[model samples]
Target: MDQYAQLLAALTEAGALGEEWRGAFERAPRSAFVPDGIWVEDSDAPSGYRLLSKAVDPVGWWAEVDSGRQVVTQLDDGRTDGPGVATSSGSMPSLVASMLRHLDATDGSTVLDIGTGTGWTAALLCRRLGDGAVTTVEVDPAVAAAAGVRLAELGLEPHRVVGDGLLGHPAGGPYDRIHSTAAVQRVPLPWIEQTRPGGVIVTPWGTPYANAGLLRLEVGERGRQSHGRFVGDVSFMWMRAQRPHAVTAPDRPPDHRGPSPLDPDLAEENVHAAFAIGLRVPGVRTLHTWQAADPSGTHRFRLSDDAGSWASVRFHDWDGADAVHQSGPRRLWDEVVAARRAWLEDGRPELTRFGLTVTATGDQHLWLDDPGNALS
Candidate 1:
């Protein structure tokens, strides 16, 4: 079997691809959407990625395209040459399939596809729902142009626009579904407005602390409100405007030094703990660092609000309690500990148990179990 067929078979066996999307997947092969040169993770490389060109190494390039892995298509938004960081990528096939399934689109359903990275998703939507029913928006002009070319080559012409996906394409109003390829800290109000009542919005939503959760929200009457639970865990590139600020340690000495009530490792090890803590504590980002040269195997868990408050917990190999340090007005570690405590008191509910409600006034209320029980 060809690589694409094998990929489809594998996805079918893994239950990632259902019969509804099998035809679309076959029609829009990933190879056609992937760029000629793609970046792969490299530990020894300065930027942690090494580019593999289709011309130079077809074998390696094809392998990456066929594999169920995200392929970085652009670095630094195509601004710089070396020591690159991925600004855009073709998402993993399984993840794409899963997100599409959550979309719950059907024949005659109008879809607004946000973040047209490679246009593969738009093509699939067009194949399933027809070209006129799908509208795709991308913020980057170059990216959009390239993706448009690919879509046109495949004779899949969805309404393509270049604009901030956060605002969404208002011209295509009252869509049956709004699907976003990018992750967001805040669901854009415009999206809710553009979606018709009872419409579904599927996107990767998360906080700065734990940026990974697939959220599916259903719009209410008059498109004034939407409510949904986190259906699964998914990590996607953040919408440009919603990307978190870089976390850095404060220059001055810590204002308070004490022992931590909870093991700092738990927050990093358990995704549910991290997600719950993130929901409770807003604007906090986490960084886990280990001293590779240190023979003692000591590591540090750092937290920062990026508003002058920062905290750190040092974990040592010895059995003594980990030392916690905090500086600035907010005791970041204390807040995290409190959040963790609340999560535990609530029986450590899994991330899926958490849900979000958004009002027309743009208030986002996160809750546990039901909308009446608000957490934030």
Candidate 2:
């Protein structure tokens, strides 16, 4: 076996790729998909990889691999430049295996792969489950075509489609598994619809400022649902179709005082939950959170177009729950108070204990634990 090939086996045995899916890891050549001139950043060394000027520089290109290093294959902002934007990449082998471990892909199982960047993952699915059983889609038509050709070059032929993955590829319906490489603020209904009743759909979902944690959910019949904890924190671009819907934060700084609205102290205690709740509310999109570290006094604002309102919510946790100031239309501070009251009355639950149930056709429903209560 080649040197990198041996390293792949080692990583798999070590549990990075899981023992079950090691077959896929063995056949795929990481070097084949990595262009010769691609820039790589190796923080382990004093400097990054020198820019490769050729595609077929056979010397040392097949060296062994390591883990947890962020490789910047594409630069100059991926939007404008097509060649190096990291439009396609061999994902960190460990992460690939981690998710695959959750998926537990089996022979003959069909998979709908969201975000077929570079077609490396599609190739993995083809290797494990057979090429015809894997259907991959990329919103970028150009990227999809290039990935298809690359996979073909590897002697694999999987169905590659160019369309909004949020809608999924209907032609490849009733898949046994569905995997998305991107993060989403809201889970799309089509994904639930496309998956087999018990099939799994995994993606990252969380606040816009921080990386989204992985959410693995199973679809139930009649729009009923059951899902558990989110996995490790990871970041990825949002899906194209779901871009229109985003969570926009309130404009006020994280801390501030406005005497006229509501109790400030309570607002301060529940401020974070309020912001997370807004994303679940209808008509809310494009959120930006700005917090004031100042303990003295500063009015925190939650601004957004969905509510068509701008308001300040202020409070100090140490001072008291009653110390509040509200200045805005529709009592924005009061709304935060409502969310807090709801949490308190129900025994202030943390995020991990929370469960999400997506039943709506156009929107998703987030419920707490086994109950049917709606969460933003």
Candidate 3:
């Protein structure tokens, strides 16, 4: 408890968290959700796995959770002798704070929490929304059962179900808010249909290649229609159904440097745009990197097609991930060029300038601030 107090204090100072939510943080000690074995990200530590023994440095463990990165508590389907791959975990406390803020959870509202890993977030929701008003779903039976016990320890008993979150819990219908701790590229139609009109559904939406943003959507009169814009950049693992068997090699590597100073702007790849491109260009992989040989003034990129053919590009620019390059036969670079051209033609509007508008008829529209500018 003392260890988490320190963590809470740090969060409170940062203004990333609130004193009001301190009870939720105290009520759910992160140590409760972490397994006995895990890994530490320090340099050159052979046994990456961490243990929960009083003799061990418990303070250090709590500190790691303070960083906003996901911690792997369980790996490789929850079976590992030592340092097994962390397949599941209690997400970082700061990340949880970000999600909760994005949710804007009001008091006494019925909320459905998907991906109840470690049950830490569920308890937090229970604190904000009250018990039974929060229902969480986990795909793994073990995860769901374990979280159920931890919630009980906190004197909370939110409904914890083990099943596919893709098919949201219909039994807990007409929820005021739906929050998914995990990321989903596709906003399942069922979620839109389940929530009450004007209810909010927040999830990290991305494509198989790169879609990264906390998507905030609002359901309307028609249970099936939703419209919203992305807020802030975020990353998450692909849903089981949204993952790729293997990403194709780049047709040719890309040049991190752009054609001109202007290209540098687009070099910062929009995760949503990246994902949308992946869906349109099915089976194309895009990668950007710097020239390791001479780090000073060289850039490279690679994009490959599913057929195993790849393309490479070279240019001079300083943006690492956002750098652009041209490669391969398919001219994936040209595709990026085309999108930018279209965006510019539309008055160089930023993506947020046009938010997503979903309709009950399954019609998805990207609305620009100037409604007249939308290409349709």
The number of the candidate with the highest TM-score is 1
lDDT of 3 by residue, 1-376 (tens): 4556776788889987876677888777677776555565544555445444324766666665544557666655566454444557777777677778777777778898988888888888888778879989998888788788877877998887888988889998878889987777567877888788988888876644455667788888874557787765666655556554454444444543344333433634554445334434445555655568875455555555556445444555533444444544455655555655555566554444545666786565555664344444
Compose the digit string of candidate 1's lDDT tens values, residues 175-214: 9999999999999999999999999999999999998789
Q: Cα lDDT of model 3 overall?
A: 0.67
* Residue range 223-306, candidate 2, lDDT tens digits: 566454565545565565554333444455434343533454443344234434443333333232335685445434343334
- TM-score of every model versus the real structure: 0.96, 0.67, 0.76
CA lDDT, every prediction? 0.90, 0.60, 0.67
* Per-residue lDDT of 81 in model 1: 65
lDDT of 3 at 29: 67
Q: What is the lDDT of residue 27 in candidate 2?
A: 73
Model 2 scores a C-alpha lDDT of 0.60
Error of 1 at 218 (Å): 0.3
Q: Model 3 off-target regions past 4 Å? A: 1-15, 18-20, 42-59, 66-69, 76-86, 250-266, 269-284, 288-300, 304-310, 315-330, 340-354, 361-363, 367-376
In model 2, the runs with Cα more than 4 Å from the true position are 1-14, 37-67, 70-78, 81-90, 209-211, 222-229, 244-352, 360-362, 371-376
Q: State residue 10's C-alpha deviation in candidate 3, in Å.
A: 5.1
